[model samples]
Target: MNYQYNNFYEILEKNAKNLKNKPAYFLNNRKISWERVKKKVDTFARALEIIGVKKGDLVPVLVGNSIEFIVAILAIQKLSAVAVPVNTFLKEEEITFILNDTEAEILIASSKFKNNLKNIRNNTNIKKIIWEGEVENIDENNISFSEILSNFESHEVKELPKRNDLAVIIYTSGTTGKPKGAMLTYKNFFSNIYGINELIKLTNKDRFIAYLPMFHSFTLTVNILLPMFYGSPVVIIRSIMPFSKIIKETLLKRVTIFTGVPDVYSALSRAKLPFYFHWFNKIRFFVSGAAPLAGEVLERFSKKFKRAKLLEGYGLSECSPVVAVNRAELQKPSSVGPAIPGVEVKIVNDELIEVPKGVAGEIIVKGDNVMKGYYKREDATQQTIINGWLLTGDIGKIDEDGYIYILDRKKDLIISKGVNIYPREIEEICLKFPGIKECAVIGKKENNDEIPVAFIELEDNAEFNEIEFKKYLKKHLANYKIPKAFYVIDELPKNATGKVLKRKLRENIEEYMK
Candidate 1:
């Protein structure tokens, strides 16, 4: 795909000139225009440069889903510095590991996570902490973000980042070992913007909604960056809880492009709404990412929202996170449509040889959206990206029509009763059960054999009955594929983006089993 701009800063500059006073962002009742956005970003960039930040410097951002998050990141980009966005939900240890691994000198974090920053100064190379929310007083190290926005003057960024320069370092979830930082360049992000826009259609006249965590690649590229690149105003919803707020904002703000995970779609599909919301809401397209869209959820969503299409997409952090999605006009039942324009997808065997279309193998992707490399881990980087194709470590297959079906994670496979069982297949079926809010299946040892066990979270008014659940499972799954046991928990462990963290469940399975 041909990159449109040299970097994000260039795009922001162009939007300032052409879009003028159009809203760049909306938070609650506040509207920030592109003109104001450019000014704030420039001033923040100057503030960053004043505090000893230089080109190629890595600045870790720990802000939440607010306008300040966008401003802080772009401001870092304006000075040609790399912005390392860390998950604010992480504990002190996880956050420290990333800060130390990146060797970032400056840290930008929201004050909501202030308790996590108690000894952050002594733990990492952090020399300054630019706090984004309410702080009683600003110390030498703890600088008030409000002060910068109000006191600093906007200055021209003499050296803007190029397409090849490193733009961000997104850390993997580190399910197995230490999290590896995927280094993404400006061109990588631009390629994703170019590739996705070709499949999913939207324009500057539309408004995009972003409630997912910004640290996730899907939210960063699709929700945050894509709309900005297209010159559309983005509605920044800080949290997804009390989901009614999202629905109200959608109606009030006239949001046309909605992006979320499977849980959000499932809730929206099952949620009974007043006819007025259905008749007047301007939701033209609903995009699902970060996890697979359950078929049952899609079917219910289609029946519920006839005017909009829930285009399910697949992506990972290493590929600038968006590889493919169902087109707005056409969609397959369970497949993540075809690869976006300019991307190549193939099912390959263990040796990286292409397999038959219908055969399940490793899914590898080749495109400009692929990351530059994993930071400071040449061995891991080489293993991930081979011959310009990223080995997704996901077991899936390409259909004859080019639609892709993700069967399961390679490591999450279960061999039960001498047959291979994919947990997602069971989990997807379980999600169809009434009163089941979320379901997660994992392989556990039973005697000498490995069996599939389920951990579920039920709806508020729903109770789990073993006989009823087993009956529900037996209807859709083979005896061997059905979970050997069911455990009802308050909630399923999830990452910031709402993807089920099976590794965590597997690690702590014994505690729940007893």
Candidate 2:
């Protein structure tokens, strides 16, 4: 199939040519122009090539959101190398596993995570490590990302990879087992931007704030890639905490585009410093995704920021992330709006047959944005991408006007504060503890919100300390991954197939709550 331009480097080049002297990024109280960006990207690509990083090789980027992150990603693509972005919050073991699993030969990690990388460097096959911050005594095996650009020289652009070639490997949290890497091609990403651009009209003048972690699909495609494609100036915000800071930056910098999860909106709605500082309404719009946005939160935000519309949407890592979003003018509450252009959505039954409109069934999507497949997992990919439809394990239905409404998560994954937490992954971690014999993890509703709960059976005549257990968990997992409460049980409920019946666990919680 003949495709539109697939190489994202080429997209940046085209945009840079048009807006050469225009401001592209505001970083550390400095403005970078598009022309300067183009030259830096080319120089960084040459630097990567000189360091023995080859085309199609997986290079893990663990840097924070900055112009450097943008440059590294574009530089890797310029050299036909695939970019593997890792979450900075990952534990050492998790980081090591990702590097090994992706076969990442070159690692570009931030200074904050350099110590963790140093501890695991001897255990992995990573050929080289480039720290984002300055480091001394690093031999030929280790280099500083700054040093690469210090004596950088501009070079001719290399031949770009085809659109179908793999460009990114975004690992989604695996509910049933290990996290699987979803291979997204250049075509997949551009198609997503194409679909989104057709629906949400963003211009070069729009100034978007990068709030979500760049490792995830939501921020990667929407916040970073989309803005760059249109040559929009972006303000990068590394932290999403202390809500006041985010609001202050949005108001002070005059950011037009705001995208975050429900937690961020909920916090903003409840922010009560003073009425005189209601200047957040200056933003053109706000977008929420990665979880269901409560209608109450939306209403409160609308009332607080009367002029700006709060838009909610849906998608997954496998779809190059965005499937549908609500239009500001034609609004709907509690609905994920319609499927973006070039994407097809369907509610299907067990036999893959489409269900009638308004009936609840699994939501399926087919489009250029659909991922190639789970890397090296053909069986899993086949099961997911059947008959050209990427079955999003989300239960929902569409109304007569094509508005998609998400009812429940078809997969047993818990999304707390926009981060995906898989039951199996948590259960595995709990089982590794000394006393735990068997475990089942489930999401229980608290104040109409979802939180992770774990039921565990102890060993024969075993004793456990909840306080110490909590500390142990904090050491191994992220704050959100740890369970809110742990219940001690004699045995876990399971079916004939040996699958833990998480439904029963949730039901037990309901009965107990009642």
TM-score of every model versus the real structure: 0.97, 0.80
Candidate 2 lDDT, 1-514, residue by residue in tens: 2446868788778878899888888764788998888888888899889988778899989987778888898899888899988877677887888888887778888887776776666777788887777687777777877877877796875578888899999887543456788999998998888888877788998888886777878889988888987889887877676567776777777788998876678667766856645644458889987766766667778888887888898888899889999987787877989988888999998788999999977899999889999987899999999988998888788999999988766767676766666665566567667766667777877776678988888878989799999999998888888999888877776522123556667767855444
Instruction: For residue 475, give model 1's deviation from the true position in Å.
Output: 3.8
Question: Lowest summed-lDDT stretch of 10 residues in model 2?
Answer: 494-503
Q: What's the distance in Å from true for residue 85, model 1?
A: 1.0
Clashing pairs in 2: none
Model 1 ranges with Cα > 4 A deviation:
446-448
Provide the global lDDT of candidate 2 against the true structure: 0.80
Runs of candidate 2 with Cα error greater than 4 angstroms are 1-4, 273-281, 413-514
Clashing pairs in 1: none
